[model samples]
Target: MNRRFPFDIARQEFGRASRGNVAVIFALAALPLLVGVGVAIDYAKSANVRTHLQSTLDAAVLAGARESSPSAQIAKAQSFFDAQRPEQFSAKTSASFSVADHVLNGTAQAEVPTSIMAMFGRETLDVSAKAAAASSSGGKVCILLVDQSRSQTLLANSGAKLIAPDCEIHVRTNVSPGAIINAGVNLDVKRTCVKASTVINNGGSVGNLEKSCDAISDPYAGKMPSVSIPGASCKSENYNPDVSTVVLPAGNYCNVNFSNQTSVTLNPGMYGGMNFNQARTVKLNPGLYIVKGGNWNVNSGMTFTGTGVTIYYADNSIIQFNGNVNVQLSAPTSGSYDDILFYEAPGLSQSNWVINGTSSSTLRGLIYLPSKAVTINSVSNVSADKATMVFASLILNNTNWTITPGNKAMASSSGGAVRLLY
Candidate 1:
């Protein structure tokens, strides 16, 4: 011990002291780490609560927007959050709604109490959500066809227009064109076709026409027309164009308004009746209307045009014609003639119609001259507008014919064409 031990004792003692100091230093470093782990666990719980609050709020807002009733929408939104989820997170929700014009708006809010963030003074986390959703007032149809055969009334509204390109025409009582007659009860024309009407044989004996016209008074509540025809009687009755016009019936039915005009295309169908109730006004642009009906009668006061207008009747639409022809309505152009044509039905024993045009008239479609007759009524201020067409034919079989001047009177497809598709 005196020789070797004396040389190493202090050094060995110092080495042991150093190892112990190193262990103490490591323990001190781990203390901060443990605290940090504890804080991270608390932060995670707070973050999850905030996220849950956000999701619940979003769901509630969407649900409120989809509700049709105000109270129900709000109740459903609150109930949804109150429902327990697998996450078992508790949330408080509030909702509100507003409706303006056709638009609806809704908002929702959700709050969740923080579990660990309270240590940092963030007592609760809040989230907000909102959502919005809209319906229109009009019918859109590019083409409307009217069958005038059995229909004795027509009422025209403002949105409807017409295109009839040909001649303004008139016919006499004895003359018959034998073409089918397509008419409307409340016929709507946006342009101008005042010259379109049935002319009686004797300006004195318009009993049948007066009766029919009288039956269906103007749904528009406009001034009644004078019954210039002798035998015309003033019968007190109402002819309703649309079922909605049963009230406020017009008493005296005499004059019909032919200011605005419209057109309809008649395919090969046999339509017996149609009505155009004047819910609104109608304006007719320059266009053509093709019609094929069994019998034809226009309600009071409608604008019908001749520029782009043609009445194409099938066989049975026109029964007989007896009236004067007014020629002033026809356009002034070469190869133009206001016309009424007759022919045998495609598949029938005998033809059904007797159509007639008086002033510079030409006719097309089916016309029965044998059993049917067409007449052109006389109207003052006759205009001889020539009649021409891509297809023109006239058939007459023992049908009377007459002529006179001054025959009066008378889109893109997008819901089918205009729009942003996608």
Candidate 2:
């Protein structure tokens, strides 16, 4: 019974049977594509949040490092982070600030909320940033000029030779030609760095001169020991003895003037002004000499000797040595002003100081004047044994200066710079 079935009925049967299988295959293939698109959206959102959090943390840590106190540092970090973070997102932040071995370290972490990834049981993205800053204390600085207005802060005139083999010279002027060396001037140092862009060397020899360098801050400003003047017990004296040799005790002298071929020995104490003219020899005992509101002048043919001593100047005081003076001075080995020979008061206006040392001059300490300019003029054959000089400005005119490492180490008075290290 070979009976022929209807063609239309067979075709309809086949179409009905394959419709369910085709739908099943299409659904199976589309599931992976949907999942992949969902994952991409979630990951992209997380990455954006993480980047923002990281940048915010970095800024917060850098701002925090400027604080000296640990508690203040943490507070500052939190404040900065709050200011920089996005308002649309919520985040949990944790920060820590510490100082170890003179280094300031700041660390911050942020946990940001995730929107798309939350569907997959991931709710947050973790981000962190760390920073470190420190001040430097090593390296000897031969010359430090703090004047920011002058185009030529350090000038080497004709026949001048300034030599410092183991140290650097820092100039803070931002004008053109922060340092200028004229004809026949020779400036030879280990390094000469200026904050300005231009340095003028006119027919002179300069060694390792670099422009646009970092500017250093005043290290001893407001950090020096204060000077106290006695009230009722103060005494006034003018010592011009006829005798060849005279010894003075340590006390409060209002005005002191010594001259006329006399040899004077000064005990360590406080004085108003010490004026010496045409003296044969003057000696300073090993202690502190605090001078206030006066000019310390050694004029014309005087031989001065001081060891283990420090001279403190305050209130519109000046130090001037003229006409071929022989000086030998060294700083104290142990004290509040250790390795410091000369110190000036802070918050004072600019004053003039001229140091003219002869061939026999030997200064073995630090000379620090935070708010004044120092000029070394026509000085020859002077030797600095572990000596460092810091001032608001400097001028070297027709002099030959040499420095060598001696009994004490020549360290920077200004603490090193603070910079972000991540």
lDDT of 2 at 60: 70
Candidates' TM-scores? Answer: 0.27, 0.63
lDDT, model 1, position 164: 28
Q: How well does candidate 1 score on lDDT at residue 270?
A: 25
- Candidate 2: give the clashing pairs: 136-416
CA lDDT of each prediction against the hidden true structure: 0.31, 0.72
Cα deviation of 104 in candidate 2 (Å)? Answer: 16
Candidate 1 C-alpha lDDT tens digits along 1-422: 55757559888889999999999999999877866775676556556655565565455544443432334445655666556221435556555655432223555565656655556686666655555432111111111111123221122222211222211111111112112222211112121111124422211111112111111111111221111112333223334443332221222222222222232222221222333323222222222222233244433332222332223333345322223332112222222222322222233223333233333333321121222322222212222222211111122222222221111111001111111111
Write down the lDDT that model 1 would get. 0.31
Tens digit of lDDT per residue, candidate 2, span 359-402?
Answer: 56889887877677777888998887677777777777888878
- TM-score of predicted model 1? 0.27
